[model samples]
Target: TPVLLPLSAAVNTYAVPANVLAAPFVPFITVPGTFAAVISTTLPWLAVPILWCCGLAAACLGLIGRAAAGFPQATAPWPEGWVGWGLVVLYVFAALVLAWGLVDRFRYWHMVLLAGAAAAMLALVLPVTALAPSRGLDHWRVALCDVGQGDMLVIRTQESAGVVVDAGEDPLLADQCLEKLGLDTVEALVLTHEHSDHYGGTAGVIEDRAPGTVLHAGSADWDVDAEVESVAELPASVPVYRPQAGEVFEFTRELRVRLTVWVAEAHHAEANDNSLVALFEIADPQLPVGQIGAVSHPLRLLAMGDMEEAATASLLRRDGVPPGVHLLKVAHHGAANGGTELLEATRPAAALIGVGQDNSYGHPSAEIIRTLEAVGASVYRTDLHGTVAFSLGPNGLEAMELR
Candidate 1:
């Protein structure tokens, strides 16, 4: 019984939900992460073979006992074969489990660990993976569809997959954008930074559509009743991938966008500058991953995550904006930060600023506009037009202003 107790505990441990441990293995298949693969690659010498050996041993013991019990020379049935059966079942399960750790490898494992992984992953990933894309055969496109004051972005792809970045100032505008894009439930919805303009009409959008995922900046003011612990809880079969700084959760290797957590204070939303800056590598049109040495479009996209001059300046230091192409999302509705040196370094061909019409802030201050213009960057303002969008085309950028 002494030996059996430890063995029983070990076997039971294998069934515990693995969500706590699964983060290390992210981006395994559809989702692009490598902590697990790294461990699997580096730690190849030990566990796999041991579990395999144990499984083989357990099966052999079970077979041997079964064979011996049926022999004519046997006097009574073997009582201990039940133990052999248990071990056999367990080891087989362990070996089979790693293959289908999550939906990425969708095979059945012990019911015990599955539940645990779900609960633990839910608790951990709920907030972090909020904006993270789901993993699947799902190919989607999300447009924060450039609804100027009112945020209205649309997410959709060739597949049935869809998500909305934000519903612009107008509820009718959002519906129009949805209709133009031929979309229903965003499948996933994200409010990058909260200002009434960003979140105001969003509730109207969510009221009708049932999305598979919803992630926001946690910025204040938006009343999110449907928000939950994990994207898994979003009445959808989707697997959401949220991340912290330096954590590379892939939107796609080329299009991958990592969230850099840059908040010193909590509760007070940074609003416009608090925008989620995503480094979407605009890969070379001609080169493949193998041939491409460095991203040609090395420009960092400052989604702002509502990061003001203070936040942007700090992030600039942390990320180190190189002397590359500048694609700036002007901070604080283009409120004056006066970071002239930073603008020169960014060397943006163009810039986009979102400010309200007749707003109180007097945003896009001339000082800031001149600063961006001084560096040879053309500016796009939401207040002047409506929704703004830039697509990476074959040659360069397909820039447009959506009204």
Candidate 2:
């Protein structure tokens, strides 16, 4: 069956039109023929079990292939000319060798070669796979890092100091972002809730330099009695504070900037609902040029932690909506839970969503994006634009990109 399939393929290549024979598909003609031959020739009773076994094996192989393909940047760009052909030949040879080892028991040398190849692969990939921020702006008053499905907002208090909100899931990513922003001093690290993604990178924030204050939603009603373990991970030297609604904090004494964290409602039953939502107001009176318009008030950023529907509703019911909210960090990665109302109430000129590309959770839902746009908001996403930064300067609020 295999010989016939190959022979037919070879003959057909010359007999048929080039377009017909050279269809854009994997040349898997032999696989189906071999399987059919085996299934057809076997006894009827044997055929059922054989088919089941083969199906199971195929399913498992497919799953393995899928898993391998899941690695970040796993696909390589097609090379040009003879280089591409050489790469294809090398891949085929390597695949055949691996298949042969699987068909026949692998020898000691084969096992050694396989182990060496795996180690070599790790060595080559590990360096490039580090989670580094795409870019940073020098004079930006606010920056939202592309932290991959988590929140990481930096409010620049000065050239060397800033307030970091909810250090994203990865420590390396958060650290790199802070470094890129030239933040030698993290004036404050505010953790909104106990969610791992929100506060997982606490250690990273304090790795080289300790934040002046580590603020967390300590023992909030929503935490279910579980301690905000993230605080325990912070540096012992740094002081931790639990901020209440109406509380105001400054990033640095030199900078004429302040942030008012308004935990509008009394409390909620879930962690996300009780997120320490804060409003950052920079009353600098200098209008900077923004992408959509001018940043008249310098900066008015609303860092909505991972607050969900119930909490959002509670906040709205308690305080309505803060007037003249300039920028909004879209809640729950733009989940349909409850952000449209707030978006409408504030009518923020710009909206930022921290999300990962092709995320499993299906974040930044299409409905939310439409809602933001409907409310006349210029939406920016971390997944779409890596490390989107807005600078509030004399010109206005300007979106910064790496040159």
TM-score of each: 0.48, 0.61
Report the lDDT of model 2 for residue 261: 77
Residues 166-272 of candidate 2: C-alpha lDDT, one tens digit per residue:
88888888888877667888888888887778877766677776788877773345441233343335555777777778998865454556778788333566657
**For candidate 1, which ten residues in a row score worst on lDDT?**
133-142
Per-residue lDDT of candidate 1, residues 234-291 (tens digit): 3445443333344332233333333333332224444554454443333333333333
Instruction: List candidate 1 segments past 4 Å from native.
Output: 1-164, 182-187, 204-209, 219-243, 252-275, 282-300, 322-326, 337-342
RMSD of each: 24.7, 14.7
Q: Which ten residues in a row have the lowest lDDT in candidate 2?
A: 7-16
Q: What is the C-alpha local distance difference test score of each model?
A: 0.48, 0.67
C-alpha lDDT (0 to 100) for residue 15 of candidate 1: 19
